[model samples]
Target: MTNLYRAGDLRTPDALAKVTPEQAGWTYSGMEVFDLAAAESVTRVLDGIEGVLVPLSATDVTVTVDGDRHRLRGRVGVFDAVSDWIYLPLGSTVEISGASGEVALCSSRAEVRHEVAVVAAEDVPVEVRGSGRATRQVTNIATPSSFEGADKINVCEVITPGGNVSSWPPHRHDGIGDCEPVNEEIYYFRMGQDDSSHGHPNGLGMFRVYTVDGSSDETCPIFDGDVYLIPEGYHGPSIALPEYPMYFLNVLAGPLPERTMAFCDDPAHHRIREEWTDEDQDPRLPMTSAESRVS
Candidate 1:
């Protein structure tokens, strides 16, 4: 068996983005999906790691961390908008209930333990990243600028509309060159309904990963609930089909003393950044407005 894993190649449970540390040959990062019906839930306590519970297709959930409780709400399917999340420190037991949909649990193995904190849906910063077809909505939920109190995790959400691209210009956080910090990343993807006349599959997209030295390269087909692991590479230009929207959750961690997402663009394609300087960012940005939620 090769080191790379594909969608169907990795057998998993109802929860997706399933990858083991041994399978990745890495120790600091882990990603998984957790789903429960209304009033149904599960409890977990990872002794040496901090975790982030991100709701994918959800509206409400009650999270109890070591007996402290926080209620989360305002979550919808991937195509709709951003949602709420909960973070738990190491060695702490977590009980999640009233979860109405699927939630992604992205954990990082760490020794530092912080208190439990809840990030509400409204507080999440939504920005339009890239321009033109490369345009997409970014919900900065757990990045350094968004949340703290975690030892080794930096998470963000990206939504690439159909016929557009995100992760463009091919960048990498694998090494320190260009002052970029090295980090391993995992991408969990979801696609909206396909409205093509050809009767295409719903929830499908494209992803490319390659080493700068040309040591290896891969561009694979991805679908809803599929996962791609980036141990080291310049990964980019994740493109959705012509008629649907693509959503992906990014989880990153590394050996650096402080957690930060730093990456260098491929020299060959870096000039494109300059070309888009004068262009307007896509008009479809800020995908969700305050109107979606009523007081």
Candidate 2:
């Protein structure tokens, strides 16, 4: 295994400032690619644009500023099938997308490995409307007992398996807490098949992002290979219509004095929380054994 720790140390202000998207050859799509040095600087620029990084192949990029390091990785392509890991120094902001393989984000000193499986739970919190889809949670690190003293990152995957995860009453993350400030997040989507072995995969799911002043409705159109980012504001309960079971990969980072999520519920259906019931796990879940590889 290659030790990628050195790549993380080179993303200083001066080095990053000297690079540009053009010189780095960061194309929207193509065989065009960058090595570790160029990839690091390119990630900085992408970070500035909140860049939507498309993976040309399974790739890795690491950036370190001063003593802090941040690393980003792409899913290893199906054929090569090699697991990749990047290390970020403590406090470096890192975002990862297009990862079908296992991943991790941690303080540089922490010995976190790629297969560690950082997601918190299999069955997550969900709120549903009468006819819409369900907001099933895949991972969460903020449970009561886990909230030791300081808040950790909040990462979850929302599945619209049958187009039922969206279109309820829209919701946001503002004022959800008193002890810690709100965090920023990313949404990565995995589009469902047109014809599931079970059913169809199409229904217009809506997501809106907004602030107290106003909101942007239907800003994110759900589709395969697209990623929507939440720098701040209300996101949604994605509703999958009759077709389209949308799966969302969510990543959140915030500064919380304590490790708990106090979300600002959507007032429209906040009352629904009172009547919710925990459904038994769908036997179809865990889709297949984790060790099983796609042939």
Candidate 3:
């Protein structure tokens, strides 16, 4: 069974009144959930599963820990600007400090930004793959940073440029297996391809989610600006339409008493792992040092 909540579900009456026009204009259509019965303490595990936080405007933030404060300044881009969207991770405890501006955070375990980058969108390289065309933009955040060690969270941007991300070979990661316990994930989508100089949005893609105890379902057609959730299960190469590419942002987290994704590969595409290599990024990532500084 599907065990996730969309951004719409997390809104409290108090939260709605607090949103501004510009901030309210952005869509909060993704998933958020939590897993409390694992080996670790609930607080540690729940830290990252707080859900995705989407900001509506630029504002100043102050996060206080034991009286020492860390500040964060939020800024949103203008319409038609190179980067149409911006994002911040979840579990970020920012206090409004005092800006007549408004910022909205989701109840998800982590935070995610769209197209907000350290460089200009034009400078970011674009890579054309079997799936479609993708513009890779590097993000600088401190929380769940990469895919190496088990930590508070993991975040990434995946652009299906030429085709679909065929996350084939179904798989699952429960505390019993390689992944840590109570791990949750979020997928925030950009638009799928339209057949032009690019490609066309094709067949239905799916997220086959299941737990080790044997429960699952295939998620429906995931399109642009859509957000999906995976509290636990084998997710995949996002299916790309034969014509165009589909894109998404993936954010993962869990109270890794052990902080790791130690799991058995779905035997089907298991061999696919052997073909992988840590080469330089495929040449198409967008954004360059000069372009990013345009602001």
The number of the candidate with the highest TM-score is: 1
Q: Tens-digit lDDT track for model 1 on 1-295?
A: 1234554565565443466566788878887776677337777787788899887776777778888888877456665556878888888998877646777788888878888888777788888877777778888878888888899988888877677889999999887455468788888777765432111246678888888778888887777667788888789879887777677888998889899987888889999888887778877665553224111
What lDDT does candidate 3 reach at residue 289?
A: 25
Output the number of the lDDT-best candidate.
Answer: 1
Model 1, residue 150: what's the lDDT?
Answer: 91
Q: Name the candidate, 1 or 2, with the larger lDDT value.
A: 1
Flag regions of model 1 displaced more than 4 Å: 1-14, 176-180, 194-201, 289-295
Query: In order, what lDDT does every prediction score?
Result: 0.75, 0.36, 0.37
Model 2's lDDT to the true fold?
Answer: 0.36
- Candidate 1 minimal-lDDT segment of 10 residues: 193-202
As a whole number from 0 to 100, the lDDT of residue 39 in candidate 1 is 35
C-alpha positional error of residue 188 in candidate 1 after TM-score superposition, expressed in Å: 0.3
What is candidate 2's lDDT per residue for 1-295, written digit by digit as tens? 1101122232344221122223323211111122333322432212211111222133454334333444444433211211233322223343343323222221101112221122111222332233223444342322334322222334344455454555345555544444134545545455555334221234344455655456444455555434454544566666555456555545444444443445665576677655445444333233311122123
TM-score of 1: 0.90
Output the TM-score of candidate 3. Answer: 0.50
Predicted candidate 3 versus true structure: per-residue lDDT over 237-294, tens digit per residue: 4665554445455555455543343445566667654444333433433321222312
TM-score of each: 0.90, 0.49, 0.50
- Evaluated at residue 48, the lDDT of candidate 3 is 40
Which scores higher on TM-score, 1 or 2?
1
